[model samples]
Target: MILTVDVGNTRIKAAVFEGNTVLENFVFEKNELEKKIEKILEKFPNCSDLVVASVGNIDKQSFLTFENELKIHFLTNEDVYPFVNKYATPKTLGIDRMVLASGATLQFPKQNRLVIDVGTCITYDFIDENDNYLGGAISPGLRLRYEALHNYTAKLPLLAFEAPELYIGNSTTQAIHSGVVNGFVYEIDGFIDEYRANFSNFIIILTGGDAVFLAKRLKNTIFANSNFLLESLNQTFQYKIDND
Candidate 1:
């Protein structure tokens, strides 16, 4: 079995896979990562391989402790993927993005694919039809947009991300929600339109904590795979095993 962990700014997600099949998956608050890892270890005693793709600050010592407990190889960026990594600063690239791109390549071989991860920040990644990982963009996420407004300015109140009824908001709270949520919808739709015009038969995959919320507003059809990163990590393991 393969254990995949994705530590994001707000949360840590872990999954156990038996070969290519995901057996169980769960998320933990960033502060509770070690506790969750211990629970997962206790639940799955036979996990043989581990892979971590973190996008936030993580305690390397805790990860090392877990690795020692399991007695399995923990995969990281030092390991190569099945496809060529064209990122100029590969070491600086977020491991989650790399793992997600690797998963996208495996799922859509010889096809153009766009991966949008909507979490603390929105990350857009593109993998071309030739199996090349063409990097994309990153922008503040829905919640971050709201938080920034509240944090940066004195008057703007902290608002939760909610669906706005109209583009023109009637109240301050509604205005903030509209600006963040509807703006993201338009941003995503416009991006898709432009990308579709350039690439033939392009595929869009949406994942991350707020994926469901954003997916509800997206005008374009997209494949919503919540466990995409985990799947990607699993694919990375398979690629390593096959290549070796």
Candidate 2:
């Protein structure tokens, strides 16, 4: 089994993969880093390779602190990728985005792919049929939208994510619900529409913490899997081993 971990802005998503199949998945808060690694190793002692893609402020020493004999592999720009990154500042490009792009390119070859990650932030990354990594957009997440409303104005209370019963909100809470939830749904569909206009037979992959919550609400058709990035990391790890 291959241990794949994706360190995002708010959480660490890890999974155990047997070849291309994910045996199990795990999520941990920053404080649970040790337990996270321990649980994986305890369950899969034979796990020999650890593949990580981190976009958070986690210290590299943190991973080394574990007493596992597994070989660790961190996905970085320094590693060779299957896609041609065309971002203006390739060096500054987030590894998460590239990983998503690579996942799309390798998983859905010879097709235009648009990946929408709805986590701490909403990220849209597009890769053409030729496997070229082009840039996309980033926006506030559901929590940020709610937090912004509360922070910016005193009257608006901090609200959790919930689907409004009706599109037209009647009360103050409902109004916030409609404005935040519906607004985000519309924004996501809009982005999909914009991309669809340019590319034909495009593959849309939606994956992140909020993916399942928003997937059913999306108007456009999408391949929804919250564990996609972890799967992508596993794929990248396999590619590295095969090439090595």
Candidate closest to the true structure, highest lDDT = 2
Model 2 segments more than 4 A misplaced: none
Candidate 2 — worst ten consecutive residues by lDDT sum? 60-69
- lDDT scores in order: 0.84, 0.89
Clashing pairs in 2: none
**In model 2, what lDDT does residue 96 have?**
93
Please write out the lDDT profile of model 1 over residues 181-217, one tens digit for every residue. Answer: 8888888888888899999978999998878877877
The model with the greatest TM-score is 2
Those runs of model 1 whose alpha carbons end farther than 4 Å from true positions after fitting are: 72-74
Give the true-structure RMSD of model 1: 1.6
Clashes of each: 0, 0
Residue by residue across 162-240, what tens digits does model 2's lDDT show? 8898889999999999999999999999999999998997999999988998988999999999988888888877776
Candidate 2 RMSD to the real structure: 1.2
